[model samples]
Target: MKIVTGRMASALRLACMASTVVLLAGCTRYGQHGYARYRTNCGICHHGGEGMKGEIPPISGRVDRIAATTEGKQYLMHVLLNGLNGPLDIDGVHYNFSMPPFRTHLSDEEIASILSYLATRGDTQPVPVFSAADVAAERAHPMTTSMVAEERRRLDALHPLP
Candidate 1:
């Protein structure tokens, strides 16, 4: 007959409890599809939309406003598909970091979901939701990062940022 020891039993119980906690934590953190994708992809630099001061532009409230306009919406799609380079001024703060393109890594659906997720954050009014079709359209006509930047400049001239 095998004897069960108290120390071994306690250690096993602790290990099981630790694993359960970890699994639950993961489920809680990645509860939504968009949130999970955003966490894995955009969270590294944007910090879940909390963005670094004067570095990464915070996409929370600001994105929703930008997305409110037609030109801004197309600009957003181009930026995501082609990435953005050079200096960007958001709400009077300057950010010069190069945003990497995610078109290669993420599907149209995923990009739309991430953009939708961003729209919900820090937004007080209703914002246009990005659809997979929108992303696909942008994907069909690929642009260089510099071109994306130029498009943004044109959009800014037309719509202006708030």
Candidate 2:
């Protein structure tokens, strides 16, 4: 067997260190923007994305799947802008509550960042990124919370959960 020289060993160690740094950075790519926003605005209701079981539907595991579809993406945008009311079922659990509107408190960019953070953080599958432009476009239409709830029903009919 060939033995590595001191120079070669040093180079290998440096390479390993560099690789580790890159891997760590990659793990933290979804930094504070979205998480901070979620904590401040959404965590009150969502409880850090874990929700309150039957009372509040957990968004962490569900959002990525909802964000996968065009209508579902729009639904998320509308829900953020307009809020949501009435009964909703997620993964066989029911949540009937009023989600207050954030349009007055958050900017389009902030909302998009929050959505992006939810979509990416701790998720293994690929999910579509929400841009500021998407939020702005939804903002232009200005649907009421009731309208948003109705749209959610329509979307559920169109794409029933399996």
Candidate 3:
């Protein structure tokens, strides 16, 4: 085999760098939008998905466990679109707060991206990625925050997630 030297080696290295840059950009495309949105819209309150001492529910490393199922995914959409209120239990901690709905400001795609990012966050095992269509399906049927909470109760009662 002939060895690559001088100009040939330089050209090869440049090509490799270009390819690596493209690959990395593509790799992060799925989560980048969600990350930015999450930071702006969610991180402050949720504290980078860690929550604030059981006062808020976290997204990273938690909750996405349920996103593994279809009904659970639907419940998540409802919660985002309609908000969640009253007392809730997560990982043995109790949180009582009002999570405002983002239906007006966040689009279906944005909501999907946020959830997909959370579900596939580095700290948690990746669940199914959400599609804009999925968010749209839930957006079609609007519900009150209390209604969403009731739905959450029904879902958790039927099938709990750890």
TM-score of each: 0.77, 0.79, 0.78
Query: Model 2 over residues 1-162: C-alpha lDDT tens digits?
Result: 135587788899999999988755633233457778888999998997888977877888667678888888899999999999888888788889889999989999889888888876445466568889999999999888899989988988988731
Cα error, residue 68 of model 1, in Å, equals: 0.6
Q: Tell me the whole-model lDDT of each prediction, alpha carbons only.
A: 0.80, 0.81, 0.81
What is the clash tally of candidate 3? 0
Residue range 1-162, candidate 3, lDDT tens digits = 245567788899999999988756533344788877888888889987888766887667554677877888899889889998998888888889889999998999899888887776634454568889999999999999999989888888998754
- Name the candidate that leads on lDDT: 2
Write one digit per residue (lDDT tens) for candidate 1, span 1-162: 134587788889999999988755533221366688889998999996879989888886777788887777788888888899988888788989899998799999888877776776645365468889989988999888999988888888877775
Model 3 spans with C-alpha error above 4 angstroms = 1-28, 122-126
What C-alpha lDDT does candidate 2 achieve relative to the native structure? 0.81
Ranking by TM-score: 2, 3, 1
Using lDDT, rank the candidates from best to worst: 2, 3, 1
**Better candidate by lDDT, 2 or 3:** 2
TM-score, cand. 1: 0.77
Give the TM-score comparing model 2 with the true structure, all chains together. 0.79
> Which of the two candidates, 1 or 2, achieves a greater TM-score against the reference?
2
- Between prediction 1 and prediction 2, which has the larger lDDT? 2
